[model samples]
Target: MEGQRSKVSSCSFVSYCFLFWVQLLPLATGGKVPALIVFGDSSVDAGNNNFIPTVARSNFEPYGRDFQGGKPTGRFSNGRVPTDFLSEAFRIKPYIPAYLDPKYNISDFATGVTFASAATGYDNATSEVLSVIPLWKQLEFYKTYQKNLRAYQGETTAKGTISEALHIMSLGTNDFLENYYTSPGRSTEYTPQQYEDFLVGIAGNFIRKLYGLGARKISLGGLPPMGCLPLERTTNVVGGNECVSRYNDVALEFNGKLKKLTTSLNKELPGIRLVFSNPYYSLMHIIRNPAEYGFDSTSVACCATGMFEMGYACSRGGMFSCSDASKYVFWDSFHPSEKTNGIIAAHLVKTALAQFLE
Candidate 1:
């Protein structure tokens, strides 16, 4: 009888410790954020473009030169992107793999995965321009991921992982830069304001769909200072190295609408934690004051001549490529350097991410 009583006490003690650990998890880490699920453009893309036939790909030398093993992994930057840093910040994992990568199976995805494709946007036309995966197709891939995850980890674990994961969407830049501004179709179809509204409408619906798919925590990234990009400054502001104020104004306006959309979504959807992550101010600050951010050049990228080179153009054979990428604000004409991405990620974790946890 005494032995049975001792066994019962031991079982009760083990149960108590398990409950205590579960309760301390949120406090020990940031929150109950289990995994980081990402969607959208090159800004957050892991390596989804590598599997697709697209000119927007950066899966070669000098791209991931600073990454582990100094080998390119299809990340646009010289190293890790913002999502990677965020994954580390949440204490989830060191790197978030691309969902389409054959190396990672359902078990790997049950932790975190990115459906983002370089050059893709909320507008399907933007993706068509470069033959990349459209937002809808990404959603389809996500559904498949869900099915596979359920099969591998059982329905309860899969459901909990999906619902507790932190979903991040970083798009819109490609829609404006690649589709609306560069391409004639969208510009002729709608004015800038109308285009902003159009994009926001799509974004709203996407968020709703994600919520329906069991995502409770979502972060939608707003547009950066597009005019400040090395490519934009080189092409838009002729004969000079000044940011195009007109383009910056458009980004600010779009961000305002996106912020409003997040607020509205939070109110409309019950039990949903939706927040807007504005990278504009942070990136602009880094550009305006490069020295403050330990950067030497803000006007041009570290790739080649830093005037007009990206993707295939920014190769290892390219002349005058900066030896130290940490000194440059941009790794390529169109994308921020890995260092810049890290800084922005840190800021988002402190501000926008805090709200999600709360």
Candidate 2:
């Protein structure tokens, strides 16, 4: 009884701290952020994949069923993703449009835009396999965005917006899962550690390029526990549907090196505020304590058959699609439900965003 009481007290104290930091966030940052610039994979893709001819897309029924107007917006979730929550938290906007979407023009981009594409990664080969936009191509679109911003909002405003914007990069899961593990060629060419180093080097160069283009406040998300995904669990039937420990071990090791890279970059670059946003522990906590986050299920997704359905396979017409997505941690095999994304965004606001904003 005493041990249980102590545990309850500790949890209460942590909750209080989280709420305190959330309340202090806006005041600490002075005013609303100028914009929310994003670059990465399906995690932050917004709706860019809708315009591209790719098999990895979610621009149809059941994808954005929980979002406003009940229309799919190419987001890989049942509703808004983390970047949408981050934009609102920073008082930027409710939604961040895709840079490639024709509906949004220069004025719409002045505040924010995502150049991300679904199924992309730090490795160009990963994007090639899926016929999605590569990170380098995203960078080119960002250059176009800068030019358009300069033309529409004038040079001074464009520079200030780009400098003050909260830039976010979320990639690498596909590099390991979709490319390194699936492709015998990549696996045969380099070991896991070597591949991680290669990806990190590419990430460093990308960040340096963003810095050259006038970005300062940047946050790069570390890899999650890939082994814990429903797809991974289903594929690991030999292990009795358990989370593959070896895959998770690789993620932990990569995150350690990525964190060190961020520290080194902070010292090496002048006036650059770069942060490594880690989601591994937080997502693990939610998976372990789903009841605390109002989730009834964590091991399976809410879409289609729950075990492996994703992208077009997880559709509204599927017979077994869950009636309530809020009860599940994941909407599809690989993406989190809107409720889970909200919880993760809140965690990032307190841990990662606050530090750089301060």
Q: Model 2, range 1-358, lDDT digits (tens) per residue?
A: 0011000121132234334545666565645478999999999988998988898999987778777777789999878888887887776677799998899998888888999999999999999988999999999999989999999989998898888888999999999999999998789989999999999999999999999999999998999888999999999989998888899999999999899989999998899999999999999899889998778988799888778889989874345677777778888989998877878888898788876555
Q: Which stretches of candidate 1 lie over 4 Å from their true place?
A: 1-27, 237-239, 316-319
The 0-to-1 C-alpha lDDT of every candidate, in the order given, reads 0.84, 0.85
Please write out the lDDT profile of model 1 over residues 1-358, one tens digit for every residue.
Answer: 0011000111122223333433443565654778899998999898999998888888887788777767789999888888987787777776799988999987788878999999999999999999999999999999999999889889998899888899999998999988998999999989999999999999999999999999999999999999888888888646486887878899999999999999999999999989999999999999989998678999888888776788999884345577777778898999998888888887787788876554
TM-score of each: 0.91, 0.92
Worst 10 residues of 1 by lDDT: 1-10
- Clashing residue pairs in candidate 2, if any? none
Q: What does the lDDT read for residue 250 in candidate 2?
A: 95
